[model samples]
Target: MSKRTAIIDIGSNSARLVIFEKTSRYGFHLICEQKSKVRIGEAAYEKEGYLQPIGIKRAYFTLKSFLHTIDKYQANKTLCIATSALRDAPNGKEFVQWIQKELGLSIKVIDGNKEAKYGGIAAVNLLPISEGISIDIGGGSSDMTLIKHGYIVDTYSLDLGTVRLKELFFDKGVNPSEINEKAKAYIQHELEKLPEHFRHTLAIGIGGTARTLSKGIMKQVAYPLDKLHAFTYNVSEHRSYLDAIPLSSAKNLKRFGLKKNRYDTIREGTLIFNEILSHIGTETVISSAAGVREGVYLEQLLKKDNLKFPSRINPSVTSILDRFQPLVNIQKNQKTKRKLASNLYTVLQQDINDNKQYEKELLWAVKLSSIGQTLTVYRSHQHAFYIAMQELNHGFTHEEILLISFLLRMNEKELLNKPLFTHYKPLLPEKSTLLWLSFIYTLTVLLQEASNNAGITFTYTNKTLRIISDKPLYLAKEKVKALEKPIPFAIIIEDESTLPKNKKLGI
Candidate 1:
């Protein structure tokens, strides 16, 4: 694979191009994304899967514009694939040949099963999910893949799609309730053929319809974070809202916060999604921003090492560190800092009333704590906070991202930012837990700054923290004295008697 790769996916409803730039052997990020609602499969379902001239013109112009972007980015490689629309069309091969001759671009028409597998690959690698059913409801077909233990187990695609249903029922001059009954019955008939083993507790939603619905749910519930990639909700809790989309009139979609552009097909998409969720016994729905484009890119990127990212490797983290970290290796003592932080967290668990649930997040914070220094030493915590919030995007839950960002924002004077904490309180752990994690993180940073390789030990008893070191820690002692504590705790530094035993250290 080249350093830069562009992936073009032509679905039934729209066409999209995403360019990914690799930062390292195993790290990559999307640099550019463009989409056009070509609706290439328009009127095709009604005409026995024949491509209409109107749809062809729209798709041709979209592809031509996409090529201009591909040139602008100088993408080293381009992978193009078409689903449902072309695969079902009788003259699909003729269109492919026409595009190739005119635009010098090759388009591979993938089967429904391959489409489902692509979505599954994307969900398994990008989202923090191990077992679930990946559902991608496109314009002309709904693709599904069963994932177990972080691998795709089986893939199935149904003829049921938003555009297909819309053309067959919603767009017809029939009664609204009649359309609903017919559409439901049609979706049920298609779902009846799904394997019984596809039923699962979790459902990963991919593609445009899922994203649009997730955005509405986020606004309705006043979700703090605006990110949609990992936004999750209980299927049972939102059943009413999910069921109401199909029932709502076109003129009334604005009340539900749906965009005007999606008015034509959202109802159809939601209806298909709801019926599928009901069929698969899904209790939870996790929205994913990645879909066929990402999966297609990753398929080539990780082909040598199987179709999954290596265990314990987070692409977002690695990409950020690779791009932002100083080449001089400013954080040479990172390993030592992690050790000290881990020790403090473990020893202070009883005092903070924690069960090591956030230990992984704390360690991630430690690794990225110094990255902000590359920008400027003054107010580096703020820089780090912003970077972690923006860059810790993939392979993490909303709660984990918020926690890691909060940990990176701590300073010596204050362990808690009350206003910021209040804003994200709904997604974060208890205030007391956060305060302790911040304190541990700040102290570890201070210790690492004072002595890169000091032999240090920690002990906590009777509301007192004892820091024992082999050599004098004059700077660490002074810094520790001024630091804020989550709870009322005294500090006794046994570092070559740097401080008097009677000195007060608790706040």
Candidate 2:
């Protein structure tokens, strides 16, 4: 049976509640989310770390509203966590007790190290990077985790959140240049205490600051895809844009397409991120939309299994299948198609170097190839392409999602030559590479559907490719021939009937 649970994370800058509907024992997806920028840490740092009455009231009402939402969803469990602000405040425990007595809600105020661990958990489980540094910049503190081989090796939480910095310096009407220098000095001081091994080439950014910066960059580049999670950029390539952010005025920030709600703290966030990149010597940053709240959900979900992370399960694909449950039978059609595609890819791989890394994506495409048929049988591939592009959210980079979508839509050669293909060319692999993979996918589908009680095998030589089937194959050769763009190799197909009666096919 499925279960509904809500995770509420009250940060120094904002309070957010995310409700996840468990689709299976190990699969779940975000069903509802809400956030309020209460700035709970506003002036608290300047005032001896006390929760201001106004901020307290704001957070109380936000939680009250969240309770209503939780009730509406019938969430059987709610995990409420407070980070930075509540944990650092002198009255933090008092406030927790007050909320428990008055609002009938239990709140756990986690320390910095635990906060950092949660951020790492979310990134390591969801994002593509297995070894990197994960950073979550909140309003009051910044959490950094060193991930090695999909596990957290070390964690550090710096008292350098955007809102915390804004309160310390920027809110005092200081010049942008002066604030930038002071913030940089402070950040350098904190980061210098960390061990050198924590500085990694790849940085997975989590929380609102990273998400907002990703949006601004996306707008600047006119990124075709609108998804925020897994959006990546090379730090060196975009250094100037990051540098210009602290000096950008509110009007300019708006012109740059930053969200209005984020305008107040974005400059501080950018400066902090700039300092972080400088300190770590990060090369590339992949933005993640999941953070502490998602991490909390994962904790609850994985507790019974005596595991901290799901083993080799792509949450994004599992969630998609759970929601759609495509008409294709998993044990029969989809599994067979995937097996054939894998076998063909293995044989074809001898001639290709760059396409080897695409094995995971190819498998995802084959698994979801028939999902569009649920929408409409006519032009189902097109529908499937749209669905994959728009809805396959987690565990994939934008390029991977786009490639899978294009591969799924490849029923004819014209689809590859369309204007849409050119528009997304930057995100796609080389045209020849795409054609090879798509051709393999097409052949798998056709061969899987063409004959029953038939086994397919592929053999390749320097200049020729041969396909052998254990049963008589009656597929239209023209369909296969159409995929031969410039014909990389000569092709031949044969059936078991053509072999001598005394001879047996090699396995």
CA lDDT, every prediction?
Answer: 0.90, 0.82
Per-residue lDDT of model 2, residues 47-160, tens digit only: 999999999999999999999999999998888999999999999889999999989999999988899888888887788778888888889888899999878899998888
The TM-score values for the models, in the order shown, are: 0.96, 0.90
Model 2 scores worst on lDDT over the 10 consecutive residues at: 478-487
> For model 1, how does the per-residue alpha-carbon lDDT over 138-172 read when each residue is reduced to its tens digit?
98899999999999999999998899999999998
lDDT of 1 at 138: 94
TM-score of 1: 0.96
RMSD in angstroms, all models? 3.3, 2.8
Where does candidate 1 stray beyond 4 Å?
328-332, 496-507
